[model samples]
Target: MMGEDADMRTMLAPPMSTPHDAGRRDLEQRYQRVCDLFPDQRVEIVNGRIVIREVPTLDHNRMIFRLLLQIMAFADQRGWTACNDIKLFLGTQVDRYRPDITVVPAEPRMWDAENVYADQTLLVVEVVSPSSRDDDNLLKPHSCSLAGVPLYLVIDPLEKTARLLSQPGRSGYVQQDAVMLGELLLLPDPWDLKLDTGKFLN
Candidate 1:
């Protein structure tokens, strides 16, 4: 399915509740307060609660930087808009997340200081780590789908595979394509770009 179709499906889907709904408000308030004090930490809210990830390992950092550089290069060449590690607010119930990489069509609003919400994000990429596999593959994609983010990419270094998720239906990605090393995956428009799996694993 195309990105536009996935977006429409996401818009029509109903909301899903997280496990920690009871103290959600309190947790959100505390997280906000902490964020006010430290804007550089890049904290996120997941499953109706706050989650702070530690500094990644050297290998993790290397992979993230490689992906970022590639995306940035693509953006530069194609005149697209790509952001690295930007916080995205995905749900009405205070679920915020920071995708490792996000790609959006070039828009003036993206540069505006007042526009904090990016409802037009075309693609979101997450680099999986031992501590975040569940969240990356399940919770994060579910939330993104509900919020109408068109495409979700999960790069699993452990498995040395990339899962491309499209057709975001009521329960997250309705269509999943697993691309192993030596294969290439093509993204939908406005990207319409091809990614080599070997480059990702290395």
Candidate 2:
């Protein structure tokens, strides 16, 4: 749903705060206002404010596409569902995110809806872009962890590296194992697989 009316481009915004750090209902209302107005736009509540990022660069888009395909292959072998850029409810009224790649249950709970519930999510992957570097590296990991997502993967195409963050807690991930391009990217527990990151390097 690209290129909509000019009025729909206008965003509803509120003063920023950490999600769940302040008025919960107010945050939801603020986001809902945008949702009702710009239903077609890709919007998210980041740091308790509506964050709308521009379309990704070519490198960023290619990396995201490659990773999504790789993850889908991995999930296919294990009979799990892997998807691209799907909206996630995250079980909190304050924030919702559409991860670059999302791994969920075979039958996701919120699959029928436009956005799926965070409960169905087993892993959330974010491919860092120039614009989203900080959030992908910091805020998003914390957000995904707090949402009870067991795994959070950060892929940096510029650096040709990836970080697998697991052992989620309220604060953030407790364990982090990083791998560079040409190195074996290992996923833990449920899907013990070594992912190939060579394509991401280029």
Candidate 3:
């Protein structure tokens, strides 16, 4: 997606808001201050707290790379865009989240090199690490849904499972599919990319 196209679509998307909780606000402020100090660090505000996990394992990194390669190739063929480890600002309280993978349709804002917002994202993918499984599997999905991201993909190597979530409701996805190895998962709207679960496990 191009930057200009994304900007136009963002105008139609819901506006970002701050979390209602006081604790969330306090943590958001702290996170912003820290981000200012260390712009290289990947951080996020989850469950009203500022949490930072280490870079993923070698296997995890390989998996992400492979996924991105595949997704990017396919997206390019279809004139779409795929980004990896990009910070998505969902709201004031939830400023920066580094999803392992994100896909957006061709739009100018999507091409913007400066800022990457959640509203620009059509799909958010979380490849679970041992240290980040809980947050990725539960909290992040709910947060992305609340932000109105269309699709959420949870890839868990530990369990060798891939779950596709869509139809976002107030809390999270109203529809979800747990796809095991050898099964294909379908994404919702915008792109509706189909992913083979078996390829994700290795």
Off by over 4 Å in 3: 1-26, 36-38, 108-115
lDDT of 1 by residue, 1-202 (tens): 6999999999999876566664676787888787787676657788866777767778777777766665677677867667766667554464778787877666633423422254577778888899889999889888777776778999899988888888776677787888885588887766777877677665
For candidate 3, the lDDT comes to: 0.75
lDDT tens per residue, model 3, 168-201: 8786789999988568887656666777777766
- The lowest-lDDT stretch of 10 consecutive residues in candidate 3 is 108-117
TM-score (C-alpha) between model 1 and the true structure: 0.77
Q: Give each model's whole-structure lDDT.
A: 0.74, 0.78, 0.75
Give the residue spans of candidate 1 off by over 4 A: 1-24, 36-38, 108-118
How close is every model to the real structure, measured as TM-score? 0.77, 0.78, 0.77
Best by TM-score: 2
Best by lDDT: 2
| Count of residue pairs whose backbone atoms collide, per candidate | 0, 0, 16
